[model samples]
Target: MSITRSQIADIAHLARLALSEQEIPVYAESLSRVLGLVEQLQRADTAGVTPIAHPLPGQRQRLRPDEVTETDQHELYQRNAPQVQAGLYLVPRVIE
Candidate 1:
């Protein structure tokens, strides 16, 4: 899971990053360590383990009651418009 100098250059190129000669080795070492950690995590055994969404147990997600809160003011607001048709604002065509 070790990253090489060429791989680091390729990664920098793909990420649109400008890396100097000194920075290349530094980034390669850091990235290699990250990949090694990920490799170690992949080796862990998780047999019969159930994935949970929330970390806390016996806690249900709170939800607000869905209801209309605002009164319809389309007609009131449309009174200020220069052009409207079929309950929709009319605009001049700009594209052919």
Candidate 2:
């Protein structure tokens, strides 16, 4: 399923693409290669093969447990800020 220059022109018209004469051949070759790859994939046999979503086997992704540690010290952080207002940090507003 190869695409011709005239077909490319029609596609460019449909997609609103402004392609020059020089660019037409370049796009033609690239689009042809892409279509050729799709045709090759269509020729492959996948009759009884089960489609696996991911290359990895396990569905339950392994990750370190989301455990909490002793880090609940708010007053220590507010002291370092330039301006603290009612246990909260304040910044200058740029919007009107």
Give me the candidate number with maximum lDDT.
1
Q: Report residue 4 deviation for candidate 2 (angstroms).
A: 0.8
User: Which segments of model 1 are wrong by more than 4 Å?
Assistant: 45-96
As for candidate 1, its clashing pairs are: none
Q: Can you give the TM-score per candidate against the true fold?
A: 0.45, 0.43
Rate residue 19 of model 1 by lDDT: 94
How well is each residue in 1-96 modelled by candidate 2, as lDDT tens digits? Answer: 678898899999999999999988888888999998888777779999899989877777778878996697889878888999998788788687
Q: Global CA lDDT of candidate 1, please? A: 0.92
Model 1 residue 56 CA deviation (Å) reads 13
Q: Positional deviation of 25 in candidate 1, in angstroms?
A: 0.6
Q: Tell me, what's the RMSD of every candidate?
A: 10.5, 11.2
RMSD of 1: 10.5
